[model samples]
Target: MVRPLLRQLLAMAIVGSTAGCLITDRVEFEDPENLPPLIESMAPPAAKVVRLDRTRSEDVSFACQVLDQNEEDTLDARAFLDFARDEAIRGVTEVVQSESDARRRSVTASFPPDLFARGCHVVEVDVIDGGAAGWDPGGQTRFRSVKEGVAKATATWFVLAYDSEGDPRADISLESCP
Candidate 1:
């Protein structure tokens, strides 16, 4: 009876190890407190989305752009735009890639007249490949949109930081011009 039990235990162990052999698709990101090595050293960190408000009758708009400070479009600009559009709260516009630098990537999202509201709007500011860590077609920086009241009439900013291991360490929230 003892011998049979030992064999059974060995078989179970082998099976468990084999099952865990496959790579698990998990990527860890940071909040606004911690940032990657590359960004942390760069002069003047990128701006954040504070608050967004707009009027419906004119060209009242905000620029949603991304800047690749490394002088190359290392991150997927298109993907970041999609994330902003899909994740932005109501009254938020699309994110557009604006500039690239030797050490940074920036994107600006505009608030169109149709989407602009009167209160504090929520916005998610995702800095795609902030550190040029790597090209991850399946990776992204995600965080909750800044929550502000519609009547406050104040702007805010949020930043998502990442590292080479594809891990984010900080997510920042800031106030912006109306």
Candidate 2:
């Protein structure tokens, strides 16, 4: 009789455990297709920037590639050339124009002796597009845009002079400059 009672208890426990396993409830999530089109359109639009390179040298150079919104519309090439000429007359002492083998559309302006003293300094470069011109300040150089009149994109780079001859001999240990 005890054995029969133990078997009945084990059977009751098994049935109780299996009861939970047999339960099923369906869950559903709303489809994205049901959402309004404006909800997806609220996302930010794609953005892009012009490529620029900054290098330190006793002599500096400027290189730029024409930008194109489409195959039919390209940044004016002559505008860049004119800007290069003007920069040479300004702070840039020497300028050399070269064509890149990698991209046929780029022009470079090389400066033989970059005009700046070796030290920590701020330089300004300008970005010019059509009638608007803006300046970008860099610790060592400035980028400027040179194009004027029609909306053409142009940028100028300013380089800070660094003395690569040797390590700085002296430095101030003060908490801050007065």
Candidate 3:
């Protein structure tokens, strides 16, 4: 009789655990037709000219406005500067500033004026949506928009040469090295 009672208790526990799995209150389902983030505009437009003083220093700021169709989805933005000669600038920080809504974000990136010499630098902005195209399990969320929810924009920075007197010269050349 004791063996029968124990067997019934074990069966009840199994049923209770299986029933809990069927409860998907915490599971989040996403739309498979989610759209990628869009870059609406960027500051310091393409082919922008910058006259920098060798003696004085100032930060070069790059910003972008990104928009995502999915309002609930989170977005991230990054910016980088690369020289025309395949040399990329390092230590540039990309800061993403989000508004009250999650659909739009303003991203700013900057590098010290000393980091860039006289040359044409290509500034690229990349915006990515927090992959909401897949479902989220009960415990943790999963990301699957590896290639779908991404956008990129590119602009050119023309840092003009300065004379010994700290005067900006009219040099439009892209040579960074002597």
Clashes of each: 50, 18, 0
Better of 2 and 3 by lDDT: 3
lDDT of 2 by residue, 100-148 (tens): 3211234344444434333322222222222222222331222343322
Task: Put the candidates in lDDT order, highest first.
Answer: 3, 1, 2
- Give a tens-digit lDDT track for model 1, residues 32-67: 342221312111223644322232244332333333
Clashing pairs in 3: none
- Evaluated with TM-score, which candidate comes out highest? 3
List where candidate 3 sits over 4 angstroms from the true fold. Answer: 1-32, 83-97, 130-178
Model 1 alpha-carbon drift over 4 Å, by segment: 1-53, 56-73, 77-101, 130-178
Per-candidate alpha-carbon RMSD to the true structure: 18.8, 16.9, 16.1
lDDT of 2: 0.32
- Each candidate's TM vs. the true structure? 0.30, 0.30, 0.53
lDDT of 1 at 132: 31
